[model samples]
Target chain A: MSKVRERTRSPEGDLPAPTPDAKQWVVYTQKREGAPFKWAGTVEAVDTELALQYAREHYGLDEACVGLITYEHGDSVDGEYSIGPLVPQKADGTDGDEWLVFTLAKRGGNHQTAGTVNAPDAATAINRGTAAFADGKACNIRVVLASDVHETTDEEMVIWRTHDMTYKLAKGYSKQVRSKWTRIRDNPAYEQYQKEDIETHF
Target chain B: MQNMLADQLANIVLMHADDKLMLGHIQSDWTGLAPILEEDIAASAMAQDDLSHALVLYEFLGERFKLDPDAIAFDRDPCDYRCCDLVTIPDEFDWATSVVKRWLTATFSQLGLHRLATMTEGDLGDRAKRLLDEQTIQVTHLNRWMTRLGRGSIESHDRMQAALDRLSSSAGMMFEPPDATLTEDESFCCGRDELFTEWAKGIGITLDAAGLSATITLPDRSTGGGRRGEHAPHFIDQHAELTEVRHSDPATSW
Candidate 1:
């Protein structure tokens, strides 16, 4: 019955000029202090500040995350996906800027923070990172300049709230919703309804 | 005296809860329809945050009043609700208007919650403090969008400006006292005039950065608005749409 919903407008003229898309930034989340950060997702933002904000709102709030980091998508260099674990190479060096290293455990698994390497450039950083972190256990290695990775500071670690956040999680509503349903229906019927609800809704 | 203070606190809490509920409902409608995929997810997540914040406030009131939180949220008559008209105004799904409206409200909410956090009255202060932590994310995102779109292309800049001009008057009305009796009590909410000054100052800095200008002045207290329960027609329809499911089965849990 909303007036805006009922109202219809005709096209006035040609469409406006299209604006260029924002840069993509890959996000990673650390579940707790001292935990290795794992790949979470990506967000599009114009700059590092906005990217970190977007990452916090999207990935950080999606679960119980203590910290998160983001880097420009283009800034990362990914090693080839191997059928098995990658063998540690002899590409060792410690000459230049720091590069944060992340490693994949398997083909489809998420990349997690392993360690760091010091190299002159991205290519050398990846080489040195593979040499240091890929110890026959990781299937792939990824490296990005430490300067490009934006992390949540100690003060900003309240990504997960102290208040009751059960309202957004599915399990938060399960108990109350089930008890309410049981008031009118029998246990069997409630179970069937729960099944359909999960399939259709959740 | 304690009872009166509690009543005023409840009124302020209701105003904030209702504002967030309506804002979340409207913003959620744009989930699949936003301008871009990333923005769509970001806006939707913030909408969920708003809804969760509303539930938290409603639960606070529920414990104090011995009423169910869901009933407090959905079963209220239109006049009993205390959200500002700025929140209920239709954005027509326009991104510029949506972003502008959120910026204006988020700025006010940040200031309002800051006042609540200063209060030593029970868990209200603690709850507000917790909510303020999350409010930073919304304000930062909207402020950046305001600046980015305002300084973007000519079309975007014009759209943002037009949206700001359209919503400025209602934005000022957000400072109106939900209860006229509380107007004289500076301690009730740190004084409406003072709150407006802080709000306008915060808003001005962002507006200046965005290169967008609009004169936002506080409205007269005598002129009643949504806070006083005199809602516009759009709110009536929105309220119906929001409670349609609950209305069908008031006793059933949703």
Candidate 2:
């Protein structure tokens, strides 16, 4: 047995008290230049910088995202989530700080960037955003201060590399792995393995 | 002189490849078990990046040496592997230790990759530049974790400090030459003193922000260690685990 395996593992005595959870931040990603940012997910982070970094590592690298934005969860005001498309309300106003608007197309779908509305506060921002972007197609309307929405700069746009990144993607290996498997196993066995892989692994 | 430079480059590349392979192997075990769900995904993704980066380096080495990349990665003898002891040490599933170790290594790797990227050699400079871009994500993520956990709470701060203290000794060994044949000038691809200075400056900024401190010094190159092909027992176990699948069916293709 190796020394590491043979050494008696000591019990971890008196584990430290758990720390409080970090603040939550919502993340959005843009697929390409001039593309609309879509809701990606949320991450727990201590601050905006950390949140954006986490988002880049988690959401930006998940696919081929070209841009990412994040805002503190507490900063955003979400309107009522309706079962059907929201009626275009007459809440037009342009009186204060700009708020970026995002609209949910369906109940379980992601929110996409709709545009921006000028309002004094979050509530007004949502109302004005709904008035501006909710074209009777959005299931929900959300608004956050444009200032609060931190974005990746040109230098920070290293989210996607120019190099071939297929190694991390399953599809990158699918064809090559399938060919290798076929060379070793029969067609039926290979097909069954591939099916199981898609069902179980994917 | 050219042959000597090539050997030194090969040695450095192998060291980095081995380090990534072991670190990725260990970290990948935490895929389903990280402290948080998002962290689990992020760590797993970074681990995948590490593994993929290792493959790229190995491919470069294979192209230079006329060998298969897979064989270069998995078929090496224990002494032929050049990963530092720091990467091979068991984190024992301790999140603080894992984060701290990765942060330290990532800082050093960023500097190393920067040097490699600047080289006039063939596609090596371009390849390292590509790897360096992805490596920025890992370093940034780890740096955030380090700072977050360090300033988080007393318990969190203490754990991070302890992890840094524990790994401080082994961390310097990353600067050791991977091959005995490498002269002082050849060992560091760039000058050792210059690399250490830049690396220390980068580490100092993160450590300062993280509210952490460690006494990480350059190890004496004359005193050989893991990069000199002398690995610890933990590395033996790690290598065994890493090669088990490859060894199971040496003739089979994955």
DockQ of each: 0.37, 0.31
Q: For candidate 1, write residues A1-202 as lDDT tens digits.
A: 3334444354589987766668999999999889999999999987887788778878877778899999999899998788988877788669999999999998889999998889998878877888888888889889998998999876567787666666656676787688776785777877898899999997
Per-residue alpha-carbon lDDT of candidate 2 for residues A1-202, written as tens digits (9 for 90 to 100): 2233343344578865765678999999999989999999898976788777778878877788899999988898899998888887778668999889999999989999989889998888877777788888998999888998999877678886556676556676787788876776777877898889999977
Tell me the interface RMSD of model 1, in angstroms: 3.6
RMSD score of candidate 2 (Å) = 5.4
* Model 1 chain A: lowest-lDDT 10 consecutive positions: A1-10
Chain A TM-score values for every predicted structure, listed in order: 0.78, 0.78
Task: Estimate, for each residue in B78-171, the C-alpha lDDT of model 1 and write its tens digit.
Answer: 9888999999999987889999999999988888888888877668888888899788778888999999988888888899999999999899
Instruction: Report the C-alpha lDDT of model 2 over B151-197, residue by residue, as the tens digit.
Output: 88888899999999999998889888887777766777767888888
Q: What is the TM-score of chain B in candidate 2?
A: 0.95
User: What number of clashing residue pairs does each candidate have, in the order they appear?
Assistant: 0, 0
